[model samples]
Target: GIFFLLLFIFLFQILYWSLKYFDINNDASLFIEDLEFQDKLSEAIDLHEIKKSQEPAFFNPNFISDYKGYALGLSNEEIDRLHQYRKAKKWIYSAHEFQKITLVSDSLLMKLSPLFKFPEWANKQKVIGAKTKQQQFSEKKNLNDINLATETELQRVYGIGEKLSNRIIRFRTRLGGFVSNQQLFHVYGLEDNVVKNLLAQYEVKGTTKISLIDINTASSKVIREFIYFDREAANGILRYRDSAGIIKSWSELEKIENFPLDKIEIIKLYLSL
Candidate 1:
């Protein structure tokens, strides 16, 4: 009986080894990953659908903020390029024009262009608003509209060459349009005679109101950006403001070493108490 049991165990072991060697599934895939493929594909499709359904309502291409630009998938460099272009008193009115300035990818343009809602007038080549001097007045247009004065109008002033006129315009732009004709003194290369010539022809009359900076509260950076204030002068003002809060009067500026004592009267025009 023991011998027969041993012989039966040996036969069973031989049978198991033979079956394992001949197994048809040995060369085939261990498991089907294709089963999970449909689930992943469905998940991706649902995400795409959700994004499409939740599209933003309205955005003015004219004023895309940093966050807005980021949400719209714009790179920092691309957004900055658009801002720099706009800072020079230019506007982005259309999808093509926006793409031209920002230079976004073609795929991104396609995605964002459909959402662009520009001002109605942007559709036309030239907007109807803000007519030029030529359009607003007749050929003999001699008015002291220095803020609205074109290069040609500026050239009409004696001693103001193309360079001088352009310089004046640039100064005006940097100051967000001049507050007073006295601001022309900020223009470089302008001789006393040329300034008198400019004064005779022009004064600061514009459509935009000047927003004065509160020297007491303003930062060094804000003061530095001022047309007349050099970096040292701006920093000095900030130091004074920090040490002694709520500057009561311009007389306190006398103590600040780098303060522009010469331009105090003119600087007063753009500073609040």
Candidate 2:
């Protein structure tokens, strides 16, 4: 009886340790699966096809963070780090260095490897180094030579798309040629990633004429030039202005339903009266 009791206690001890160490509660597995799904879903969201109606869906960081956490078994700190990494280029070590990154796991690092490629190009170029082959090619393709180049010519640039090219041309017609690439970011529908990619490849020549687009007088086509305001949002802004009268101040934009804070902030820079 004494021997049997001792044997049972030994088995229980082993089970307890296994459960504790291995996280037998199943939370880890669930979290890892959730992160995988989030990654797949994110990839599936075609940034090109995304409309103003879809902006709300895309902007919800909480939803994205929560889903990612479940998929990757990430702690709050790990989730925050992931978002920071996405928003800006940051230090991302290898899977072996996961222990060094607080709250990050080796498995999570492996999963995120696809999104976190090292900036090899960034390293090669010094701050004052001569232009790279890509940069030279980009500079040679100037937007000012409209007689030679069409909308397709602009699209050849790393981040320039059909929508972006159209916006650029429209802005050029309104205010003249792009004096700076920073002005491209002011155009509606252009993503920050696109702007960053453009800045990496090309340097804008000359000074930008900082024209404040009058929200009251600006056409739908003109208003939609801002990247955040899709066709629907532009129409909504017009409709509200027509019905209620011109937006006297930026604060009046808050009255418009579904006008996201981030979008408002972006629009504020370009809007006047």
TM-score of 1: 0.44
Candidate number achieving the greatest lDDT relative to the actual structure: 1
lDDT of 2 by residue, 13-131 (tens): 99999989777567677656577888878866755456544543222221235475656567777677655554452333334333354456667655654444323232222322456
Off by over 4 Å in 2: 1-67, 83-103, 112-171, 174-202, 213-222, 225-229, 233-273
lDDT of 1 by residue, 1-273 (tens): 999999999999999998887674664555546868889999999999999989777676756778989988999999899878866757676788888999899999998888887643354324323357776454225657788888988898999889988988888877778775556656789886687677666766667777888887776678889877888888888887778877896657667868875456567777897
Cα-based RMSD of candidate 1? 20.8
- In candidate 1, list every pair of residues with a backbone clash: none
| Residue 258 in model 1: lDDT | 89
